[model samples]
Target: MTTFDDRENAFENKFARDEEFQFKVTARRNKLVGLWAAEKMGLTPEEADAYAKSVVQADFEEAGDEDVIRKLLGDITSAGVETDDAAIRAALDAKLVEARRQFIEEA
Candidate 1:
């Protein structure tokens, strides 16, 4: 292949890898947030895991984090747990940091 073709291929590969990494990070963050919410709602260990998976799946409902955030907020309130949007957003941020750290370590 020509140098130009090689460069294009490399860029495409990098983009793909970056997208995959982001997906993993988001999924991990969702799971972490789900676990935190679960604990707040007094869920058992098994229930927490299931809830986390559901949170992960909830992300597929939309293109951004809003869907996941909405799901968590609704679930938390529905469970009669006391929490605000700001707290949930803070948790989401914290979990994203943790998820990125874990992902980097795994790499």
Candidate 2:
């Protein structure tokens, strides 16, 4: 039987070995993180999608999550989003969890 941990570790090993998959995972997860970030800051869906694009772009630029986050906050600041990082990150984590739930249900 394939245990969850075994599957996760296999993926981890594959990630370390496969540049293409690494890029794909980075792009996908960063976009998801960006969507989470945007909703956390209460952006409209359009703005959130824009933020997700930005996050993916940032990842393409080889920036870390913190840099992507900093960029996101900067954009939100320029756009006048009011929530602080703690609130936004927390809301994002919650939203991400909910989104995953919805996605799994849909699947």
Candidate 3:
């Protein structure tokens, strides 16, 4: 193969790996936010775990984080938790940082 072809292949592989890493990080962040919301809603430990998984799955409903945030806001408010969109967004941002740190540590 030509040198150009080899470099192209390497770039493609790096892009794929980076995308996969980002997906994992986002899912981990979703789970962390889910656990945080569950605690705010006073869920049991088992329920919290399940809720976290559900939050991770919620991401599939849309392209961005809006779907997960909507679900959490609805559920939290329905459970009588006093919170707002800004608060949830803040938590999501914080959880994302934490999630990235956790993944980096694992790597």
Candidate 4:
């Protein structure tokens, strides 16, 4: 193969690896969020597991961390649970800010 073709292949592989790594990290974060949401909502273990999986699945649709966090908060409220929205909001907002900072640093 030409040198240009080899370079293109290498770039493609790097891009794919980067995407896969990001996906795994995002999934792990979503799982933790799910567990937290369930605890906040006073859900049982089975319910918490299911809820976490659902949260991660929803996030798989390209929703960013902040968006997922907001939605999870809303979901807890919609379930008629007495959760501290202000606390959750603050936590999510702080996390969002950190994520942005990390992205900037990486860039």
TM-score of each: 0.96, 0.51, 0.98, 0.66
TM-score of 4: 0.66
Those runs of model 1 whose alpha carbons end farther than 4 Å from true positions after fitting are none
Q: Which lDDT tens digits does candidate 2 get at residues 1-107? A: 57988999999988786876445555666677777667757889998898799877875555555666667677667767675667546644664565556545765
Error of 4 at 99 (Å): 12
**Can you rank all candidates by TM-score, best first?**
3, 1, 4, 2
**Candidate 1, poorest ten consecutive residues by summed lDDT:** 62-71
Model 3 regions lying over 4 Å from their true place = none
Q: TM-score for model 1?
A: 0.96
lDDT per residue, candidate 3, 1-107, as tens digits? Answer: 69999999999999999999999999999999999999999999999999999999999998999999999999999999899999999999999999999999998
Q: Cα lDDT of all candidates, in order?
A: 0.95, 0.68, 0.98, 0.73
Provide the lDDT at 36 for model 2: 67
TM-score for candidate 2, please give it. 0.51
Q: Give lDDT tens digits, candidate 4, residues 1-107.
A: 69999999999999998997666656656666677788877899999999989987887566555567567878888878766657666655554455445655776
Give the winner by lDDT: 1 or 3: 3
The pairs that clash in candidate 3 are none
Angstrom error of the Cα, residue 106, model 2: value is 13
Sort order, lDDT high to low = 3, 1, 4, 2
lDDT of 4: 0.73
